[model samples]
Target: MTKILLHGCCGKMGRVISELSKKYDNLSIVAGIDKFGSDNMGYPVFKSLDECNVEYDVLLDFSRADALENLLTFSLKKQKPIVLCSTGYTEDQLQLIENKSKELPIFRSANMSVGINLISMLLRKVAPVLKDNFDIEIIEEHHNQKVDAPSGTALLLADSIKNSLDTETEYVYGRSGSSKRDKNEIGIHAIRGGSIVGNHDVIFAGDGEVIKFTHNALSREVFAVGALKACQYISKVSENKLYNMEDVIGLDF
Candidate 1:
């Protein structure tokens, strides 16, 4: 069995992962870490990683970015692999993750849905072909409770397109105030409302025609499943490196 140390076990995604893992015989949530501890999760939930005493093969973190330092410290000290599924990390925290990955296996992704990752791949393939003639725009929707303004998946898609282009390009997040759209910029807009699972739209517009690629997440189960898959993949990996969904899905990006 793959013993899992579930971080942020009290949150929505964490609870989803915990319940989903019960359906798989090979996966077991041995322990959980959350600021808000719970008693009915079928496992021990600690307020912090320091209090966790159980043996586990890998750690899956769905906690906020603020908790990243502690999670990384715990993982590195234990020589354990970790799958980080949180978003809204600052540049310094991202760099820290990259630096720490040199010593321990770390899998990190903003969005764990396989469909979103696949969309990123598709953008890479299609962006270069359309960059010169098309104006690109990305629209993302999430629940109001999401702390981040533009969802990480939106940025992921934008990055995929930006990297593919030969010319310099910038991202404009929700334009306003008397500025015309730049030809070499990608526009990203965010919408937050009542309990939206997730929605992303990538639009490529030319003079006469428009092409759009969209993905809608109807439920959180998709991410939970992907996280579990990542946990399984990282648990077997001996290489100390920063991994992503592409690694779990076995795709070259």
Candidate 2:
């Protein structure tokens, strides 16, 4: 069995991963780490990694970026692969992750949904062809309780569009100020309200026609499932590299 130590085990996505992991015979969650320190389930829940005594193959982290330092340190000490599902990382933390990728296996994705990763692939293919005449904008929506705006997924989509642009593109957050849109500008807008699971739309507009690609996440299970699949994949791999959703789904970019 591929044993897992789940971070953020008490949170929404963490609970989802905990529940869904049981459906797979080869995968099991052996322990969990949550700030809330509640484990109604049979597994032990620790407040921090240093307190955990149980054995696990890989760590699946859905915790916040602030928790990365301790978690990354412990994972490195254990020589274990980790599926880091947290967003809102600082630039220094991201750089730290890149440096650690050379020492241990690390899996991180802007979005865990398989469909979203495929959307990233689609954006890459379509962006180059449409950039000259089309104006691009990215709009993302999430639940009001979410802490981050212009979600990691939104940035992922914007990055996809930016990579294909021949000219340097400026990222415009919102149209609050009174100014006309620039040709080299990529607008990213965030919407927060209700209990929205997730939604992303990338629009390309021209004089005559407009094209928009959208993905709607109806349930949190999509992300949970994707992370579990990635967990299973990473548990088996011996290579020390930073894997993305593409690595789990057998796609490039």
Candidate 3:
């Protein structure tokens, strides 16, 4: 079995991963790290990595962005590969991840759902073709309990679209003022209510033609499954590089 150290072990995603690990013969959670240090998983849960003494092969963090720096330090010091699925990182914190990846393998993605990653690839192909005439807008929805707005998947989708176009683009989040739409601006809107798992819709409008691409997540298992696949892939690879879902899926696991 590929032993795993699961961070954010007490949250919803953490619990999802814990339950899903039991179904995978090759993956297992050896220990956990959560702010509460709750030991509900039968494995020891440490409030801090400094107190961790268990053996594991990979670190799967589904925690918040503030927890990233410390997690990266511990993972790099211990020579452990980590799967980073957290979002809402500042520019400096993002740079920190890039810097640490030079030492150890880091599998990171804003969204771990395979479908969303595949959509990112498709956005690259279509955005350029539509950039000249079509105006692009992104709308994302999630559970009311989610703390971040526009969703990480929304920003990832935007980045993929932004990279394809030749012209520079500015992201306008939830526009409010009485202003006209600009050609170089991409509007991102967020909706939070009920228990929606996840929803993202990307629209390209020009003249009389419109193109819409959307993905709806009905269950949280898709992300958990993707994370496990990544963990399995990273456990076997010996490269000291920053990896993503593309790398994980490319391995054909």
Candidate 4:
């Protein structure tokens, strides 16, 4: 069985993950970590990862990046693997995660939905070919309470397109007076309004045609289930590795 330490197990997504865990015979959340005083489903909630006494093979972290450093430290000390589902990390923090991948298996992804990962791979392949003829734009909308703008999945999609092109491409968050998009720019837009779970649409516009690719997340449970799948996969992987949704779904990205 895949014993898991589920961080942020009191949150909405955490509850979804816990419920999904019950459906699988191979996966179980043996412990959880939450805020020091927060109650979390009767599981012993440790304020810090180092305080946890339970034995688990891997960690499924749905907490914020502020808690990442401590969690990663604990994982390294225990030589356990982790699947990071949180977003909004500064560039330096991201660099730290990449550096730490040299020692442990870390599966980090902004969006764990299988469809979104496939969209990323497809954009990478199509961007370079349509670089000159097509204008690319990404628009994402999430719940009003979402703290981050231009969600991590949006950045991932933009980065994939940028990397596929041979030359550098600028990202245009918004266009104001006297500013026109450059030929080599990718526009990313964010919308926050209601309780919409999640929505992403990428539009490729050319002179005569426009092609749109979209994914709608009807429930947060998709992410929860995806994270659990990653937890199971990470529990069996060797150290010194980096993985994403493509690895979990066995697709090329």
Best by TM-score: 1
Q: What residue runs in model 4 are displaced by over 4 Å at the alpha carbon?
A: 36-42
Residue-by-residue lDDT tens digits, candidate 1, 139-232 = 9999989999899999989999998889999889898989788899899999999999999999999999999999999999999999999999
TM per candidate: 0.97, 0.97, 0.95, 0.95
lDDT of 3 by residue, 167-242 (tens): 9999999988898999999999999999999999999999999999999999998999999999999999898889
**Clash totals for all models, in order?**
0, 0, 0, 0
lDDT of 4: 0.86
lDDT of 3 at 127: 94
Per-residue CA lDDT of candidate 4, range 1-253, in tens? 9989988888788888877788899878888887743564645677667678999899889978888898789889988898899999889988989999889999999898878888889998888888789899999999999999989999999988988888888999956768667888789999998998999998899999998889999998888878888888888887687888888888644
Candidate 2 lDDT over 40-62, as tens digits, reads 95689998888999999999999
Give the top-scoring candidate (lDDT): 1
Tell me the TM-score of model 1.
Answer: 0.97
Candidate RMSDs in Å, in order, are: 1.0, 1.2, 1.9, 1.5
Q: Candidate 2 — which pairs collide? A: none
- Candidate 3 runs further than 4 Å off: 251-253
| Candidate 1: C-alpha lDDT | 0.93
Per-model CA lDDT versus the true structure: 0.93, 0.91, 0.91, 0.86
